[model samples]
Target: MDINYLLIHHDELLTYLREHDYAETYVNRYKTTIKQITDNASNHNWTTYEDVYQWYVDQSYSPTYLHEVRAIIGKLEQFHLHGNFPDNKKSYSSFWKIKSAYTKLSSEYKQLYEDFETQTCKGLKSSTVASYRTKISSFLYELQCKGATSLSDVTEKDVLTCFFADGVRKRSGSLCANIIRFFKILSESGNEEATRILAYIPNLRIARKNIDYLTDGEAAKIRQVLEDSNYSLSCKDRAVGRLLLHTGLRGIDIACMQLEFIDWNNDRIRIVQQKTSQPLEIPLLPVVGNAIYDYCINERPMSASPYLFLDSRAPHNNLTTDGIGYSVKKIMSAANIRQEKGRRKGTHIFRHHLAIKLLSNGVPQPVITRTMGHTAPESLSSYLHADMKHLRECALSVEDFPMAKEVFQSCLK
Candidate 1:
């Protein structure tokens, strides 16, 4: 803790701090605290948290400053012990812990759940896997509460009750689908009870609701907002907004974009769509291209991270999907674009807007399908509901159905 020793070792400490992307203010504070400790500590060789804390207390430092100094001492001690700073930021959610129902399950059911989880992890995104696990856990917990300790003991009535409990009938479609998948997994594991329960559960047919898309005026307003020099929006915001509006890239795609993905020479951007894992090549329109260029050149932080978009703050981590969605919503609000009730108001609205634009321009369904990365041709059918102009074109004349008049007269008589 000698001042001379810290001065000599300043380069090493600075390097460690910088490597962790510690903010400038934090780094300066640490340096100041280390200098004070070096100058004042009776012994210049404290190697443990207790020794350091005692030294600070002996100095009669205030409680807050004592806490701060202790934190620095802890970091230094960790470095001496491990040869590297411990990642204090390392954390994860407890939601992913094994469900309580697992302990009550029969050995066979326990193994079945484990296998199902493993398979889901392999085929689905982490978020989707977590959702499936939650739903399955809830169902299992419900069954256990109903006095069914094993999968074999679960009756069709129990399954129905669990699916319909607590006003679940209104939201039963997705729950029904999840239950169906659970039963399928169990049936695959050779559980005859699961197959029997599956046979008795009727499919809940859910209607597809029309998605909200920006009208031409709203789209124009958004573009104008992005291009406005006096607007308070940051360069990153403008870049993300233009990319979503022009290319219809999903939020995850924009968040995960890399510098290497841009083919500047060809004026195209290539991305592996995160949701579908499909490779997409979108033309780099000049306006959108300029916005990205302005952001990268002007506002993007200087970091070695490969991602094109990053959090502007220190640590400079890649942007998340939620972050991008929030940016889009902010821009929408600034542009005075009101979100309708029950309509999704996120970056995805831009995608829907792009699809509607393509459809309005008379782009063929096959082309739209490819552009939107839809696996099925029929997936574009919902957009038809919004294309009233095209529907009018397809309207048949009443004169063309002369037999309809005679049928009406006969019915009246």
Candidate 2:
């Protein structure tokens, strides 16, 4: 459809959105985006939606804003061609196209995945189910490539080759775990073939990588920058930074955090974690509490989103994990952290710093685990590698194998 046509019927589109239960705020935001894109199209003498879309992509909007623009523009094109666009929430499963391997699979192999998904995923969260579906589809595809036609046709060598294939070892633990779960479910349903295949899945040793975290000096710089009032940070930015620094909340958890999660009267913040679906309650440190209040009272947009943090513009939807990561980068830039090339600068670094700080202060691993809302106690072991204070205590004396004084002098030089 042409830009002129969209511009002419933009009002009709907005009305249609409202009729489809889109929030009024979202409708209004769509109207604004439509006008903006159309105006740009007119100035550039661009007639088609594709022309406007290409132009929009070249602009310097933030990642979050760009996503909103892309979604609105795509919806407009869909509405102009058809009478309506697909409801995103209802189209979740179709969003991830099943791999070609599954497409080529004989009916028997395909049934294995379908049965596992339909029967085994009954009580699992949608995200977990989606993950399992992807893993199983990929594994089954590998089995097909290895010349297996059916479950009964598979051998231990086929299973081992699939498990140890290139780029699979890093996640061998999770991939194997999910695959095993699928087989166990099938076995319980009396698939004897599945029980035999289960015996072929090998246990994998997960290799832990060194974690990068903010040093005390770098963390102090972040604190100073946030408090300086010289960086012109939005209250929401400050609030998110403080939450990550003080509360050690995951970016996804922070993104999904709701207004009601806070207990102002008791100075505690409660949440059901997104990763593990477990409940966690943490103290609302005064720094975090004040920033949140400032954002909500003074800076937050006028919207009815139950989420605590939101997009600044109309519709004001909950902030995404990407949005939270962007905020962390912004705060780190203001503090002059991680500007060096190849340095890691994700929000999880703050999480790691918090855990290591807790460990350095002599907090028990169980206490730290609960505070971090880790799904398993072993999850905290990675941070132990970053806890330099206690690690030093475990160091052995070098007196027994001391080098010559001349060698030490040469090393020092």
Q: Give lDDT tens digits, candidate 1, residues 1-413.
A: 23355557766877777787778788887778667766656545664446666777887889998766666766665554454553443222222236455566656666767887875568567777777767777777777788887777878788777757675663357867886888788788787888887886769876566666678898899989998987789899999999999988888899999999999999999988787677888899999899999999999999899999988666778898877987887897788776656656788778888888898898988888888877678877877788867888989997876786679899899
lDDT tens digits, residue span 1-413, model 2: 36656767778777766776667787788879877876666468665556666677788777888677767666666677665653532222221234445677778888888988888677567888777767788888778878888998899988887766574553467677888888999999999999999999887755556776789999999999889888968798999999999999999999999999999999999999998788999999898999999999999887777999987744467888888988888998898889888888888998999999999999999999999999799998788887889999999987978888999899889
Q: Candidate 2: which stretches are off by over 4 Å? A: 1-11, 14-73, 77-105, 114-123, 145-147, 155-157, 160-173, 184-192, 195-205, 400-413
Q: What value of lDDT does candidate 1 attain over all alpha carbons?
A: 0.77
Clash pairs (backbone) in predicted model 2: none
Alpha-carbon lDDT of model 2: 0.81
Best candidate, lDDT-wise? 2
Instruction: Please list the C-alpha lDDT of all candidates, in the order they appear.
Output: 0.77, 0.81
TM-score, per-candidate, Cα-based? 0.71, 0.75
